[model samples]
Target: MYSISIITVGMNHLAYLKSLLHSLYIENHPKCSFEMIYIDNCSKDDSVKFIRENYPEVKIIENKQPLGFGENNNKGVFASTGKYIAIINPDIVIQKDSLDILLDYAEQHLQAGIIVPQLLNPDHSIQYSVRGFISIKTLTARILSKGKDNVNNKTVNEYLCKDLDFQKTQFVDWAIGAAFFMHRDTFAKLGGFDLDYFLYMEDEDMCLRCWKNNMPVIYCPQSTMIHNHLRGSSKLGKKAWLHIQSIITFFRKHGIKIKNSKEHTMSL
Candidate 1:
């Protein structure tokens, strides 16, 4: 039996955080085989105090200085002592037996470096959480239709091969960072998420690194979790700015030059 460490980065989401902790407590997993770490990234609310009083079992890392997603998660990663590390968001709730399926998949597929479970919206609708590569066109389309509706919904299914008859686990270019699981050794090999990305696109950067190492990022629909993804860089104003900055940084760091609706410079 392999031990697992669950890491979550949160700030000011006390209500959702409590629900998340409670879900974990009732989740049908062997408690002796896993541990949870919450990194409070200088939250202005009473999240720290709340965790301290209620969830004493969770090891809380109080960040005196504010840290971004990648940095704060890295803090939790360093503190974890599990063979596999699960990067989860505070708003996601793992369904009963979800961890069992994920662990079983990981054990069966040794070549797969990173794994993502099927992500569902709050209403139990199938959310295409996996993605292909990113380009300027994708970025621009997403920017053009920011708050009104999901631009990705139009092309996400085809991109993720959801339209095909393939229902089994398959390799993917990238998986959303909302909920990701990978071996501790693989995380060390890839150096974890790049700290340069303050918030968005860190998952893409990490996926690119895993691809370079000839490791596959897999999507297993057998195991599913409801991801309340209405947080962070998806909000109205500041989220857009952070997203654009991260896009530009992602291209520059990966040497991908945008052309006519295509970024052909990147190898994978």
Candidate 2:
């Protein structure tokens, strides 16, 4: 069996997908033995053809109908034969030793629910991928802070985990779904992502479940990757509507609790 299974879903992300695939394969970024799985979400572009032609070794799961992020990842996990599985984005470029670092940490902290590396922008600035468990109050304050520059963005800052030191490795509430790692057993135990979240908020729900189950969410700064973040939630119509719907579903499943990140921290 492979040491790690890297899964990524793409919908017309041909350019980004090429960079990611090249970095993983041609550059041989991962140190451990791995199986690559790419889920094509009914792309209108020639993404499937390119993968089949350029990287035949990569297992491709093509969909007739577009699927959600969580569903695509679950499908990849179902097809994987690795001890560890990473559900990442097509826009992320992996480092040679990134997976090995996370694997070493996972070996030591076997109970970790989700482990994520530091995500950097193209210019090498840190992305706010790590965050505390988002509460309704924090969400409301973030919306309110959009227009006012002088307003204290403390609530939003805390929600993004800016209150904590970003340089040090620590247990956090959650990380973005762009790059999430977990053992196959842990994923099976958690039942994977909740189907209730069709688009967004699935990552947060999974991490919240992890915390509820006393499993730590590890943030390893030493393992860094570059992510070309496409902020779909910031879009005007459909994406925004989906985000709102997911938020409602999340709150329905688990009530809007306003606990801090310190409360969720484990002995790790």
Candidate 3:
């Protein structure tokens, strides 16, 4: 089997795709055997044609219609023949051999069901990629004036793991799905992402399930990647509504967990 399958799903993100492909194929220079899989969700632009012409080595999965983030990534994982899988977004640019670093960490940390590199802004500042699991209070705080109050800020930060040291490798409640690396077997056992969430919170749901099933989500600071994190609109819009709905579904699946003492809450 290939060492890893780097899967990126895009929809009309040609500009981002160009940079991402360049980073992976040229700048990255993977150490082990790996396959590049790009799942195109029926983009009207020339995303498919560009990859076909320039990067013929990439395996393309063209969708008949646009699918959600989870579903699209699942298609790539299903097609992967690699021992490990890297599900990254098209907007993420590889940095400093980040994929190899995460791969090494995953191999050493057998308990990690979800292994992620530190996500950074273009200026190289660490992004708050890791977050504590959401609770009723956490959701309430966000909805009520976007956590402006101190009490609400504290509640929100608790979910965001604001106090954690970003420079260390540790166990986190969840990491954003934008750049997740994990064993193929572990992901299969978890049954991929829940299709119930079309966009948001699927990453949170996946990480929560990992802990429930004794697979810890790990954050490795040794490896880092740059991500274009879109802090979605706070106003009640299509994206915001999806985020709210996913929160409800998450709570429904697993009742209010106000901070489980059994699970590792901080760095290991």
Candidate 4:
């Protein structure tokens, strides 16, 4: 039987976390055994206590100090004992048998090191999770566009791969970190996520490494999940700054340089 470890990092989003947990419990898949692991990032909302009291089956790890996204996930992975580790966000609600579908697809495509499900909005609209490699022009366009629908722009179109049909499963350059499933051995081979990243772009970095190691990063549209995505970084303040910093770090590590653009660019 296949085994999976569902790992999720929590902050102060208690209500969403509870909803996610309920969704997981209700979604049934008899083919595989799974365990839930929650890593609390020292949330002030008593999230750790709530989980322990209500969901005793879930293994909880309380972080004394808040850690970055990659570091918290790594800690969860270390505590997992499943063949596959699923890194999921607190705000995501899993669909019925979604985990089984992803696991089945991953088993069939043994060469794929990482697999991502089709992410849907609460309104049932498709969320474009798969994306192309980030370039200076693409980054500029995304920042300028500010998360609006501007696929008409050439750079934004290419960056978002607007030409591709997301209804079909295919190999992708990378997908969002909102949900990621990887083989234990493959994840270990990549040395987990690079700790240099604080919160953003770590998904892209890991997918890049997967390609370098000759492992395909797959996008599976068969399985779906609803993501309560709040583009927190796009709003303003420290989150936006952290997002920019991660972008710089990713580009620097990959030897890609961002040039100043005089023309107005669109956001993604």
Task: Put down candidate 1 lDDT per residue, 108-152, tens digits, no spaces.
Answer: 787778888888888997776777677665555555665333445
Model 3 lDDT tens row, 201-238:
89988888888788888888988889887566455688
Q: Model 1, 174: alpha-carbon shift in Å?
A: 1.0
For model 2, residues 1-268, the per-residue Cα lDDT tens digits are: 9999999999999999999999888885677899989889999889999999999999999998988889989999999999999988999998768888988889889878899999998988888888777677877886677423235687777677665676898888788889999999989989998888889999999988877877778899888889998887765589878988998898888888745447754577
The parts of candidate 1 lying over 4 Å away from their true place are 30-32, 147-166, 257-268
| TM-score against native, each model | 0.87, 0.95, 0.92, 0.92
* TM-score of predicted structure 4: 0.92
In candidate 3, list every pair of residues with a backbone clash.
Answer: none
Off-target runs (Cα >4 Å) in candidate 4 are: 27-31, 149-151, 257-268
> 1 or 2, which is superior by lDDT?
2
In each prediction, how many residue pairs overlap at the backbone (N, C-alpha, C within less than 3 A)?
0, 0, 0, 5
- Candidate 2: lDDT of 19? 93
TM-score (C-alpha) between model 1 and the true structure: 0.87
Q: Which model, 1 or 4, shows the larger lDDT?
A: 4
lDDT of each: 0.77, 0.85, 0.84, 0.84
The positional error of residue 226 in candidate 2, measured at the CA in angstroms, is 0.5
